[model samples]
Target: MTETIAPTPNTLPARSIAPWLKFTLELGPLLLFFFANSRPKLFAPLVHPFLPAKLLEGESAGLFTATAVLMVAVLVALIVSYAITRRLPIMPLVTAILVVIFGGLTFYFQDPSFIKMKPTILYACFGLALLGGLVFNKPLLPVVLDNTMSLTETGWRILTLRWGVCFLFLAVLNEVIWRTMSTDHWVLFKFPGTMILIFIFTFSQVPLIMKHELRGDAAAKAPEHL
Candidate 1:
C-alpha cells in the first residue's frame, strides 16, 4: 500500500489576501508610479494639489513626482493590507520602509539614484536575512512567509537557500539594470518585470514543497476516525 500526506495549505498565516484585493494593493502603486514617471505632466495636476510647488517643477519633476506618489501609494497599501488582514506582511513592510527612506532622500537630494537603489538594498537585505538564519540552523522563510505550509525541517532549509540565492541574484540584477538602463526602463523593470519574476519563482517551488510536505500528528491520528 502506498502512503500519502495531506496537501499542505498554500495560504500563509496572517498574510492571505483575496486575489482581487491582492492584485489591487500590490500593483496599484507600481502602476501609479509608471504613469507618473512616464507622463509627469499628466499626473502633475492631479498630484499637484497635494504636493508642494517646489516638487512640481524643474528637470527632476518626473522622478520626483513618481517618487512622491509611490511613497503615498505604498503607505496606503500597507494600511489597506493591515485593515484587511489585521497583520502586516514582513517583506512588504520592509520594502515600504525602504521606499519611504529612499523616496524621501530622492526628493531631498533631488537625485533619482537613491530611489533607484531601493530594490537593490531591499533584495540584499532579504537575501542576507534568509541565508544568515540558515547558518544558525533556523529557517526564516516560514516566518517571513507567514504561511501554513507544512514542510520538514530539511524542506524548509532547502527552500530558504533557494530563495536566499534568488534574492541575491535579483539584487545584483537590479544594480546592473539601474546603473546601465534608462530611468523609465528601470521603473518598468522594477515593478512589472520584478513582480513577474517573483511570481514565477514562487510557483516553481510548489512541486518541491509538495514532495517534502510533512504530515502532522493530527493528520496521522485522523485515520483512526474513519
Candidate 2:
C-alpha cells in the first residue's frame, strides 16, 4: 500500500501569485497614500467614520487622513497577497508592522512626523538586518526576494552587500527628503520617486545577477538555507 504524505510548508505547491499582481499589491498602498495625501478632502469623508474625530480636524488633517488610508491600504494588500499565495513575503510583512506601529502613533498623538519617520525606520531596519545576516554567513536577500533566482555563495554575498548598502542609502535619502521638502513633495518622492530609484538600481544589478546566475545542476543544488 502506498502512503500518502501531506504537504508541509516547505513541501507545499510553489504556485505563488503572479509577479505583476505581487508588484501591484506592493505598489497599491503607496499610490493610495500619495493620492489620499494629495486630495485628503476627497478621501476624508470615506475614512471619516472610521478614524478618530480629532485626527480629521487639524492643519495636519491631510497627513493624518493619508496615514489612516495608508494603514488600511497596506493591510488590505497583505490580505490579498495571502489569499492568493498562502504566504506573505518577509519584507512586506515587516513593512506592514512598521506602518501599523508608526501609523498608530501618528493618529494617537496627531503628529505627522511619526508617519514621516516610518520609511526611514523601515529602510534602516532592513539594511541592518541584511547586513547583520551577512555577518553570520547568511544571505538574507533571498528571503526578501522570495528566492526568485539561484546564485553561488560568492554571488549571494556580493548581491547582499550591495543591497544592504543601497537600503542604507535609501534610508538616509528618505530622512533628507522628508526633512527638507514640503509634505506634498515628500509624498511624491515617497511613492513614484522612491519606486523609480529602486527600479533603476535593480536594473543596474542585472549584469551581476546574470554573471553569477547558477544554471542546470548548479542551480538545482543551490542552497535554500538562507
Candidate 3:
C-alpha cells in the first residue's frame, strides 16, 4: 500500500468539523480495534462463516482476525471523514495506509508483530517531522494547529517542541508496552491511556498560549512581524 503524507495539522482550509463528529471519526475505528482484539473468540465466530476455513485455523488466528477487522474499520472511518467534510484528513489517512500495510502483513503471515508495530511507526514519523522542521527553523505546528488556536511564534515553537517530544516518548512507550505486556494492556494504552496523557500535556500549555495571545489585528499584522 502507498502511504500518503498528511497535510500539516490545522493547515487544511476546509469546513470545520464538529468536536463530537471529529472525535467519532477518529476514535470509532480504534474502539472497534480494541473490541476485536479483546474478544477475538467472539469476533472469530461472527466472521467465521463468511471467511474461508483455512484463514481462521491457527494458534494466532484470533489476532489475525482482529487485525483484519481493524483494517476494515479504519477504512470505514476514513470514508466517513471524507463524506462529512469532503476532504481527507492527513493523520488518519496516513494511519489508514499503515494499517492496511502492516495489518495485511499480519493477516498474510499470521504474525501479530506487524500490526503491533503500527503505532510506533506512526509516532516516530510525526515526532521526527516536527523536530526536523524545527531544525530547519520552520515551525510546522502551525500547519497542524493554526486553525484550532492562535499563538505567537514562541508559542508555536514551545508547543511544537512538546508535541514532538511527546510523540517520540509515545513511540518508546508503545515499544516497551507491546514487548513486555499482554495485547489487551497495549490496546487499552492505545486509546484512553494515550488520550489522557495527551490531554494533560495539552492542558498544561493553555497558560503559555494565553501569555502569547495576539491581540486585535495582531494576526493580520505585517508579514515581517510574523
Candidate 4:
C-alpha cells in the first residue's frame, strides 16, 4: 500500500513567526494534522491506515509525534540563535518551556482539552508572576519588554500593573471559551481574539504612557526659546 502525506499549508513561516500571528499560524499544523488524522474513515482508501484514528476523544493518529515535531523545530530555532549570537535567550526559552509543558500533556493524555487549556494556564501563570513582581517592587514587563519599549522605573511599575491585569482578563476569557463554547469555537477565537484584545489594550495605554513619558532627545531638541 502506498502512503500519502498532506502538503504543508502556507499559514506560518517555516523559519520564524511574528509574535502576533504566531498563536494562529503555529496551530495550523495541528488543525491540519488532527483533521487529517482524526477520521480515518474520511480519508478512507485515499490515505493509509498508518495514520490511526484519534487515540482519545480527539486524538489524532501519531498526535504526539506531530506535536513533537513542531516543538522540536522551535527548539532548533533557539539553538541556532544561541550558536549565532552566543547569548542566552529568555523569551524564546520561556515560550519553549510552555510548548513542552502543554504539548507534552496533550500527547501524554491523548486529550484535546490539554491543548485547549494551554493558553489559560500560560496566561494565568504569567499574570500571577507579574503581580508577584509588583509585590516585590519590581516590574516584570521590563524584563520581557525592555528591548521593545524602555521606560523609567515608575513607568515600568505602571506598565507591569496594567499588563498583569490584562493577562488575568485573558485567563478568564480562556476559561469561558473552554467551559461554555465548543472546542472549535474556542480554537477559532484563540488567535484572532487574543490579537485584537492585546493590540487594543496595548495601544490604549499609549496616550497615558506618552503623558507620563519622561522627556527624551526629542523634547530636548525643541527650540530653547519656544
Best by TM-score: 2
Candidate 2: Cα lDDT at 85: 79
lDDT of 4 by residue, 1-226 (tens): 8986654543322343356554443444445434433343444443333323444224343334444554655566666655544543565666667777887777677665676677787888889988999898766775665234545567767888889889999999998988898655665566457767888998999976776564677444432210
Best by lDDT: 2
Clashes of each: 2, 0, 3, 1
Question: Cα deviation in Å at residue 181, candidate 2?
Answer: 1.8
- Inter-residue clash pairs, candidate 1: 12-147, 13-146
**Candidate 4 weakest ten by summed lDDT:** 48-57
TM-score of each: 0.83, 0.93, 0.83, 0.65
* Alpha-carbon deviation at 12 in model 2, angstroms: 5.7
Writing each residue's lDDT as its tens digit, candidate 2 over 89-167 gives 7989999999999999987777799899999999999999899999998989998888889988898899999999999
* Candidate 1: segments with Cα more than 4 A from true spot: 1-16, 49-59, 215-226
Total residue pair clashes for candidate 3: 3
Instruction: Please give the CA lDDT of all the candidate structures.
Output: 0.85, 0.89, 0.79, 0.62
